[model samples]
Target: MHMGKSYQVSAKVDEGMLASALGSGDVGVLATPVMLSLMEQAACACVQDCLKEGETTVGAQIDLAHISAVPAGMEITATAEIIKIEGKKVLFKIFCEDREGIVGKGTHLRLIVNRDKFQQRAAAKVK
Candidate 1:
């Protein structure tokens, strides 16, 4: 996808998504890993339309800060904007917010790959 293209994905925090429930922390709130998944979900949607059939994007790296805690039952939205594209690599600026304001922000890197080929490579690792 070209630079500046953007997309958003939202999710409601629940007991299953909490830090205590996910075992990421002792406190009851949104977990960092879950927040990052939402961010990656947004990034994937942002470039879905640009991919050819049998192609998909996989997360390569993520650098983010979970700046605030979102308790259960609150909805949060993550927005991803394409900041740069280098060959098969795509870089995105990500922001996650709750009803009040921003809760997280960071950058993510994704690499485009043929879906079947990528799956095959991963499956080969089990052999």
Candidate 2:
């Protein structure tokens, strides 16, 4: 995948995405985990068209900071840029923003993997 590739994904915060509903916290605001999931979605979109069939990227690490709380009903956008690629690992710089301004920022790492192989390994664990 080419460096500097970027993608953006957005979602409207709802009750199901709230920190209180997610059990991450007791506040009636957007959850940190939801923000992280959006960031991961943007990152995946950045490289999705480049992946071969049966290949996918799995999140490996996330170093993010939720700087501000977003209340439900606000629209949030997450943007990710491919900053580095090393072997099978890809690094992305990501950030989340609301109508006011940036709400979170951080880096995330994902590793390219064969989907069937990864699923097979995961299934084996239950057997």
Candidate 3:
């Protein structure tokens, strides 16, 4: 099994967007900035899918740029590919596109962690 794999994620882009230069005021269909979230989630899933026996996955870092402002009600798709693997740590590259063109790109890192201990440590971080 390999950690650096690829996956396709479907998305809904917003429509009717406008730039700040236009004072009249029309805003693009605001979305939850799905690209970043999708990229991270895909990396996590890939790490989990490729984990060997007794291994678990956890997200470590994600560097992404949301380049395009998609209007409300449009559709988009983001693709993620794992680029490197170091033992329990995996690196991925993600790209996103909508009807207009490329919207975002970035690299992400995920680490295989002990499930029980990971959860405990995460819960403790919430001060």
Cα deviation in Å at residue 10, candidate 2?
0.7
Q: Which residue ranges in model 3 land beyond 4 Å of their true spot?
A: 14-33, 124-127
Residues 16-93, candidate 3: write the lDDT tens digits: 233322333445443334567666666666556666666687678878776877675677777778788777777888
Q: TM-scores for all candidates?
A: 0.96, 0.96, 0.74
Better of 2 and 3 by lDDT: 2
Count clashing pairs, candidate 3.
Answer: 8
Model 1, residue 10: displacement in angstroms?
1.2
User: Model 2, which residues run further than 4 Å from truth?
Assistant: none
RMSD of 3: 5.1
Model 2: per-residue Cα lDDT over 52-92, one tens digit each:
99999999999999999999999999999999999999999
Ten residues in sequence with the least summed lDDT for candidate 3: 16-25
Number of clashing pairs per prediction, in order: 0, 0, 8
Please list all clashing residue pairs in model 3, or write none if there are none: 13-74, 14-71, 14-72, 14-73, 15-71, 15-72, 17-28, 29-72
Q: Per-residue error at 116 for model 2, in Å? A: 0.6
What is candidate 2's local distance difference test score? Answer: 0.96
Residue 86 of model 3 has an lDDT of 79
Measured by lDDT, the strongest candidate is 2
Q: lDDT for every model?
A: 0.95, 0.96, 0.68
Query: What does the lDDT read for residue 36 in candidate 2?
Result: 96
